[model samples]
Target: MSISKNLPMLSILAFLGLWQGLAFYLHSPLLPSPETVARIFWQHCQSGELPYHLGMTLLRLIVSFAISMLLGCSIGIALGRNEKLNAFFDNWLVIFLNVPALVTIILCYVWFGLTESAAILAVILNKVPNVIVTLREGTRALDKDLLNMAKCYGFSHTKTLRHVILPQLHPFLMSATRSGLALIWKIILMVELLGRSNGMGYQLHLFFQWFDIASILAYTVAFVGVIQIFEFAVLKPLDNLALKWR
Candidate 1:
């Protein structure tokens, strides 16, 4: 309805135009035209191959995201509330945070013998630290006055959490969630690429081996479209609702 809404479409069109032009000029197998990619994408969809692989990757992403968010938020809140605990685990968090994701994926595959558990574990390990850092800062920034008020009112821990603590932490939780989705999905791709028998990443690997550029781009575009849909349909609405109290 507005220019802001139209801008995304316009930009996408301009990108396609540029890509089409470059692709035509290059006439290269490495950089197939968008139309070629789209055609392959459609064929994959019609054959159900795309959906199957995409679903596998999505499953891993969802599981890893859930575990990372739950564990990270709980641990972050505990550490933020206890100075001694925070001090002790601070370096541990730093160590994990600084660990390269590729190395983690490789180690998990080596140690766990390329099982699904190891793949998911690798993704969780890689993502949890990021969530911890985000939520720890949020916990530290919580309103002391509100917490004291809840205490004075004889509120139970659960009640206080639901009414006073959680409301304030919603923004940070959303931040972790959004970042988690992005980060976990990527890690899952690497996990899939390294260890798994099936998924978008595995399919991409096969495509790479055959130098199937159009197929590779098709898978990438499809996954990105799915991510975009999720952000718009789920995360954005949830963010707006959660922050409405402010």
Candidate 2:
């Protein structure tokens, strides 16, 4: 347990040490020392620049994620329950799932122009198919016996959904959300980089143009740290809640 607990810190220290050593060995201004990068990161934090960009990026993610979840789950439940509808849409869903995200994003940007709406839509397009596929499988696997039992007990559609279907779908919803969050955040960043005035991705693009490696690394670290916090605080709790019965 102690070894497991210490592993992350030890690995981080090792990485920092390696980075510092490489900077010293190379003796390049472009390759700043870890301390220098940390100092720069601190300055950005003090100025509140990092927090603003972080908040904006997170806002976009929340909007995109919420929209994707709503639409994806609706479509998934429909398709799962209706064979004809599923057969009709199966090919389209497969195509979207298999298409490259970059291509989709580029085409979306061209179609909608370089706007926030376009970027969010691009993220949705890239992420929704995944959620649909996952939830559809879950819906298809639901126990008909339990559903009939609910009907036998005179449960309404709402009641069945609330007490019967929802419980079975919870795990799949959690799985979809977990995977979607991991994927959509990165895609949103890519959308930001491709076109947008503000975001972590835009900042990273600006830093790259000037070859500011430290700032680039700082932005990346900041975003990754946020993702970790979300995983532990939000997704972990949801996963526990969903799997509690199991």
Candidate 3:
């Protein structure tokens, strides 16, 4: 079991070794060695720039995620529970889901004039439909016998949802969350690239102008490291804890 787990880390080290060998052979400024990138990444950390900008990006991710999940789950549950509401919103949901995220982001910026609200709103708009679709399916697939049992036991709406509905919906919610994080972070970077003054994306843009591949890679490594830590330290733990009842 330990060997299986360590295999991924070994593969990463092997890949980095290959990368280092290539950088040594090419000897190009454009493709700095991994050690060079790590040195630069350390410099940025010491300067405090990386921490501040990365924090900004993470904050946006949290805010937009909260908004989309709450609103989407509510809307999805309502639609799923009501045949008429589902029919009315079905096409609109399809429209939102099918719309390109870049188009939505650009439109929000145009209409809202490149403000923070616009950035967050664009992210929420892009993400909400996906959450809704997942949750709506979960709601639809809910066991009728379980619901009827709850009804027979005089379970209040809130109680029924908490103990019965939500427990069954856990898988769908987890699915939405995993996909949402994967998607929202990339879009957040794009949002920052297009408008924001500070973030990993904005910093990367500056590096791009100078053709500083090392700085770009440094930022990429630092930010992606943070994200990986968050996944392992936060998301994975929460997932395990939440699903432990099963």
Ordering by TM-score: 1, 3, 2
Off by over 4 Å in 1: none
lDDT of 2 at 105: 90
- Considering summed lDDT, which 10 consecutive residues are worst modelled in model 2? 237-246
Clash number for every model?
0, 0, 0
TM-score of each: 0.95, 0.89, 0.94
Query: Candidate 2 residues 194-239, lDDT tens each?
Result: 9988888888889899998888878878888888898899888888
Candidate 1 has its poorest 10 consecutive residues by lDDT at 237-246
Among these predicted structures, which one has the highest lDDT?
Answer: 3
- Backbone clash pairs for candidate 2 read none
Better of 1 and 3 by TM-score: 1
How do all the candidates rank in terms of lDDT, highest first?
3, 1, 2
